[model samples]
Target: MALTREPPAATVDPSNPNIVRWEDIGLTLIHNFITEEEEAAMIEAFHAQDPQKEGKRRISQHFGYHFDYTTFGASETHLTPVPSYITNFLPRLPIQTYLPDQFTVQYYPPGTGIPPHVDTHSMFDEALYSLSFGSAVPMQFRMSGPNDARKMRLPKRSVQRKSDENTEPASSPATAEQTQANAQAQDAEEQSACWEILLPPRSLLLMTGPSRYGYTHAIRPRKTDVIDGKTVPRQGRYSITMRTVRRGDEIGCNCAYPGVCDARIREEMAARRDGAI
Candidate 1:
């Protein structure tokens, strides 16, 4: 857990018009982070890769490093280098101190979603970025608790277009002022239970600090999402998550949230057991 290098800054500028900052949780969303053509190319590249035939609900591929889900650990050995399609876009991301060497590309079909969990702190560095494209989805975030985390499942309901009689109008792209106003309103209404945010197609989501370490994010399984009181249909979504791998003597993570930091928690437990003996 010793310092291998200076930690990268996790701060985001509030003045950036494209950024929607939930400062309280250290989450930021950047709209239109990539061009439409770029998104298409990435999606095509993902398809070109041989698909996994394990009958898994979601399809995923890893580059640079293969992450083991059971252990929540990354292998020290390197895999295939990150393809040019993904590496080319890394420079444009906000992260400046260190470029990510590991990335995972996932394809989510309609009605399929991931369970709530945090990225293992000891495995990667701070500042994780996920670029989403091909469809829009709503991600739910909640503070970690002692109880066993459950997969979120919402009842499937029929979604009607706003133009239909007696239905509310669909949400339109808001001006910067309106977006800020809406975010402020939601801030007041949302409590510690959970907060939901829409991830539009071609948007980039940045998670660092508390958001990256202390909370769990998940997507509810559903064919459609209700946004702004209107129903929006879901489509296949492709997300590219990039992270800097922690290697060598710095493999253990040292962070402020010891309760959540895997390395720190293990050390604390071992020390307590030794003292009792």
Candidate 2:
């Protein structure tokens, strides 16, 4: 079986010349998603809401819900509504079935960047969108390590055992050897799949399916980026990341990538112990 799957063909419009699809990773970049005038206005709006007048390497604000970074969870109560300036562009977004309720505006100065991370699976829906303005930067996406891949592929069947019980080994030598071989193969596959996409000013990026669940995205800290053998200096940039908050009585996230889903992992561990987690 292939390690990566192609995104649905219908995700991008065939006649739309602005869409660039990275099908294997389920990412679409729409060039010039916002006009230059709109980008400037959005930046002005962000500054109007900024509490600090002094220069900061990074500044961020959240709307609709406050995100707790320590717990990686969103507040249950809704905060201030998303501003009209931001909502005005909703009609142009590719997603139309529903609009995003949560968004964060972040500012990054030159030589600063965010660490690689995957959004909490249980906290938000599958589709994630970000609008970039003020500057262009290279965003890197990487597949999870082999250990995570192994966990995703293997079934969770181990149960809690009594200390006094004498149990046989979990697997025979041949089985262990096969598992090691699989891990090595997975590591090779992931190592070669790293991608660096250039996110330009006034562009929008859409991430879904595998790209949202199976990979981590980040921007390396640097003053400049090299693309196609040409060096480009970095500038101050602002990004608006929008997402739909997930709510319901559903037990946990049932996404295809269980290894990376915190809710699913917790549920499985609880099942193994026959107790609540």
Candidate 3:
């Protein structure tokens, strides 16, 4: 009889402090949150489309390919939208309320992954959660500045500008308050530790506290992570990045996937509990 291996129970516990598991900020899985149908559909479309990848080292935007609730229109279900696979479980998890109101999909094909970088924005906290699908790839979590990552695209002088350019962390600000604020703000930029892990398909990675805000994470150079001794080159992959973003132009906004709309928005939840979303 062929033994069947069950999928890793979708987990959302606080990241481990000793090594940063998933229990640092009180995150536990409320429910699996997403269905096989939804996951398969998204993966199928993403692979079929094969969005043009800007390539590795592109820090201005998504390195491989990009799609998200804002651009794709994912405000149908509750628990803060962006689909339940990534964000809905946060409320029950150890992670405190400071959640991001956003969720994005990232596609990484062979030889493609984000360079070492930190995701910062007023609307986004220090954490980044990822749900991978389609294929397996190793995501290199690292601390990169000018010496670390060669290319960067930090666009603002505010919290978002995160580059090791002409501006040093200390010289970036002026007054003492500004310095303290900058130091406090750039706490994650100064980190040096990094972890490299293979994000398998149908798996979830929630980065919080320091992992999100403490240090930079990157897709390290392409290499084989000796699994069962079979060298696995990178393959096309997809992810459902769920998070909480401050409500946007709720009314004017609409679903905008160049691929598929799956539009069923604006209908009240009470009217339809079919769970098609």
Candidate 4:
């Protein structure tokens, strides 16, 4: 008989002194990061715009630089000036050097969800921030490299992992053979694998470091979310994703995240580094 293994559960970051975390993933959450009024104002701004203007899932705008949605490339379009509301809000956060030059606000009604994807690396800076408003929903993340693929979930409201005695800790690094075996096992188990995270309304989630490069995030299509055995029906949910554009030359990148970087530029940099060209 084949042995069946249980999928891993989401755990609270024991190492982080702040809000709960998912193992070593570089995710930070701040509950009630925005006031009810602020949330309302942002939503109102969204409502004020023509929904058809940007298309179905979301509306996007560029501040210092524009991104062409169709071609998925940086556009030469005129820069849209950042509004006072955004300018005023920047100083309120602890991020001293972070400034967003691009923004995307997505609306999700019932029965809607996004496929898992990491924000393109070369197109945007390292840190990406998102603010959630409206009703609460769960967001899913899965690590893609090395086929290690661990699944996790972010539920609505607050959530915490249980004490060490009651939970299984992450496994130690494996040998080459063991790693290959584990990868095969995980691939077969992935359909049922996921860790749950509780996200409250009006919370701010920051993705940086390994979390930004190593994981793909998505939301599953469903009408309701089950948390603690309670069913929470989906309502209108709005997510505002803010990122800084990676400009050309000095403002551009030469980062390790080659998966999302421009192939031409990356090749040129690599050639230069190796003195091959």
> 22 in model 4: Cα distance from truth in Å?
4.5
**Segments of candidate 3 deviating more than 4 angstroms:** 1-37, 45-100, 143-193, 221-225, 246-277
| Residues 39-128, model 4: lDDT tens digits | 888777766764442333544445545655643445667566765646666775546576777766667766677656666666677778
Q: In candidate 1, what are the lDDT values of residues 1-277, reduced to their tens digit?
A: 1112222233546677777777766788899999999998988888889555234367889998876554566766648788988878778888777578778889888877865667778878888888899899988776665421111111212322113211222443447686576555433423335666788999999898888987777787888888788998877888988888887786787766665567866686688889952
- For residue 211, give model 1's deviation from the true position in Å: 0.4
Shift in Å, residue 197, candidate 4:
2.3
lDDT of 2 by residue, 24-131 (tens): 778899999999989989888888888553474488889888765644657777477888878899999887764788888899988788655677788787789999
Please, what's the RMSD in Å of model 2?
Answer: 8.8
Clashes of each: 0, 0, 27, 7
Model 1 has an lDDT value of 0.71
- The model with the greater TM-score, 1 or 4, is 1
TM-score to native of every candidate shown: 0.74, 0.76, 0.47, 0.67
lDDT of 2: 0.75
Question: Residue 123, candidate 4: how far off, in angstroms?
Answer: 2.2
The alpha-carbon deviation from the true structure for residue 20 of candidate 4, after best TM-score superposition, in angstroms, is 3.7
lDDT of 4: 0.61
CA RMSD of each candidate after superposition: 14.1, 8.8, 15.5, 11.8
